[model samples]
Target: MRDRIDEEITFRKLEVLLAFMETGNLSKAAEALNVSTVSVHRALHSLEQGVRCALFRHEGRNLKSTEAAQMLADVAQEVLTTMSDGIRATREAAGYSSDRLKIGSLYSLTIRAVPGIVIDIKVRRPTLQVELALGSNAELLDKLKRGAIDAALMALPDADPEIESIPLFEDDIFFAAPAGSPYANQEAVDLCDCRDETFVSLGEGFVTYRGFLEAFRVAGFTPNVTMRVGDIFSLMNLVSGGVGYTLLPGRVRGVFGDQVQFIPLKPQFLMRQTIGVSFLRARERDPNLLALMAVCRLRTRSVI
Candidate 1:
């Protein structure tokens, strides 16, 4: 037969018992816990039945606790305290980042989008430390899934049940070339005209690299890539230094406006990279994540 305590006892009942013990009256315990007085009475009654003992005695309209009740209350407090600490440690071990929020994002966003969000989030939570991890879109998403980062800001990917994505803004992919290059004079650059041009691109995992390939592919040719780099900043430097031409999102224009030219792509080759924040769906209710989400939503509202 199942033990009565094992079958009927619950942490919630213990909470009610502790509250009653602290407040010394069912009505007051209910007020403290924000529950009805009858609910408190029921929890205590159920707790006594579960332990199969007389934990309390009625004294007119009030209940008086026995020695056994005091013992159980002490154990319950210890158990709840230990469980709270254990849960925090476990979440940190699993990459939930309780003491600080570790956010991963594409290097391109660090120029503007990320810095603004970081400042606003810090303003909202003065004591909470925030760390930024910069990488390609794929790298950020990988870190998020592995629990290395609490959230990611990058090009939103296809739906995954485990991830909850919040779209913030869309950035256009522009044809990037050295400022003095012949292509810079154009109103809108067509990818087909650049087929004969040499290019430098971000390696396979980058979202911009994928856009680079698709734009040229639609032009009915593959780019003659001279070099492939890991990060967008390096790729931008190569273009500015006249290493070769490349495709980049408009977000980087601010940093390279003088050294490089960003021309809008012809309609057929144009693509918008949807930038957004993504996080584990399981952590949607987490207070830290809720704060970050609130900031992201604020940005979304502003841009719209």
Candidate 2:
């Protein structure tokens, strides 16, 4: 017989504690749990009163775990994992398996690389239906954390303990100019040449934008930004129309379809961004994930 749940140990309390542990901030934890922040606060308060001990110490919006709280969190994770596997097992025993796989990626990648990989996977696993979600890097990561997506193909995110990332491809950054652009025929051009050019760029808060800024710093010049827009296709379109030149990833040629010409910078400026597969560490062991990883590994190796 299974042991009874503790009178005070409600699933709600465990969920509150686990969410806090997963995300360092209360608001984000509430977001992950799909509950109001106030509800989470009340649940923790009630839990503390019932347990007769302080489980969390507040630091601004963050809840730092006490030793006891950490202990409970470890067990809570075990409980959650057990519950998840139990459900999966029950489904499998019923002769039911998920028919569709959810995949995600950034806009730039969805146009070419991700589709190619998806098509290849479909040919190999005809029983699987692939669903694609496209978004910015941050949005996709949030979806993965909340179990909204199985995995994504994207640039490496900021350091995240919960995310398990693997390298797939290394793309170099290049300078893209319109045909007959001033620096077009030049064997190589100085970074400063772009200093005065009206720069069309991706909006702030993109990994690519951050990398682009760093590349400029390395090239020893600050670009004159005349416009900022979202999506690489639009940026490429603007560049093609002679609005301004922008830094282009080596793979941009594959997506932009010969609409733009790539010029090698004099010093050959290249910022290597790995386009890899990423998923929550917690789901890393799912059988579907394992199969997907095998497909990605096989495809990525062939390309490299």
* Tens-digit lDDT string for candidate 2 (259-287): 68887666656677788889877677666
Return the TM-score for each candidate structure. 0.72, 0.65
**RMSD (Å) per prediction:** 6.2, 17.4
Write the residue-wise lDDT of candidate 1 on 112-139 in tens digits.
7888898988998888899889888888
Positional deviation of residue 146's Cα in model 2 after best superposition, in angstroms? 2.3
- What's the CA RMSD of model 2 in angstroms? 17.4
